[model samples]
Target: MAFRVREFELALMHRMQDLNAGKVEEALHGMSASRAELRAAHAHWTRLAHAPRAPKGAAALRMALGAPPYRGSRPAGSLTCDVLRWPLPSWPGLAFEALLGPGGEVWNQWFVRPEGPMTVAFTDLTPWACVVGDLGASFPGAVQIEGPAPHHWTVDFPHDGRTYRARFVYGLIQRLE
Candidate 1:
């Protein structure tokens, strides 16, 4: 999953470069990717959206609770993708959207969803709650710094009679204990 997302980062970087070069036509107008490619991209993105950030960006988000800060190629930017129409309401339209930020890291990150992020409270998801990735449950605990963590942050939950811990940096999850 990380490998695929890492590759998607490259695709996003190149697209950003083209957009920055004022080549809107090149960025906006391009041959669509294959069905397999689209699935791979989505799989990669989903993992990144809930991973941990790096050391420098000093920005961290709880992967479980919501998407990170980067939805597209860059912060506050958007990306277009050619997705299959068979899955009803899986994403949005041919072009779903979310928000993205650099967070100073690469692999460990998260992004908003088709709509975007929202103000949330951590207390509601911790203590004795269950967070299962299989069911698409996110437990991005509360922000310890009251904002993006300079180094990292964490949230704990009770699942399967065990106390599970998730760490975050740059709005990504590094590990789960």
Candidate 2:
């Protein structure tokens, strides 16, 4: 069976369920999708991800999301990586990005701010309002820490002389502390 963008988005939500169940529920209602559908989508994605015969990395993403709208290269330490981005229907301003190593292996996959200026204030730091890049840009010198699970990230930024830690899943903000 072939997976489409909706399934991809559902899979994303599945990863986020642990951190933001209420938000996931709202998204599910917004998509008019049932919990069963979400579970099935995630299962399909997991199978595809692990199947030896299935397309891997960027190819698998292209299979599910179609061709990326943006393709470019970015410097990663001493090496440069190919970056591919595709827009998700639910998040107009954010795009799903995949960083491919020299061998075309996908090193990272997450939502990111597409090329453009992003202005974010503390007031705008609500759940699901922004991506990891938004906070890094808005609050310069923000420190990124790997989260407890895959696709999870925590960014610590300073504001009003206080530090805030924002949790994200798939690079989309889930909550703030």
> Best candidate, TM-score-wise?
2
Worst ten-residue run, lDDT, model 1? Answer: 82-91
Estimate the TM-score of every prediction.
0.24, 0.96
| Candidate 2 lDDT | 0.93
RMSD of each: 16.1, 1.1
lDDT (Cα, tens digit) per residue for candidate 2, span 1-177: 469999999999999998999999999999999999999999999999999999999999999999999999999999999999999998888899999999999999998888754779999988888988889889987999989999999999999899999999999999999
lDDT per model vs. reference: 0.33, 0.93
So what's the TM-score on candidate 2? 0.96
lDDT of 1 by residue, 114-133 (tens): 33233323443321121222
Runs in model 2 deviating more than 4 A are none
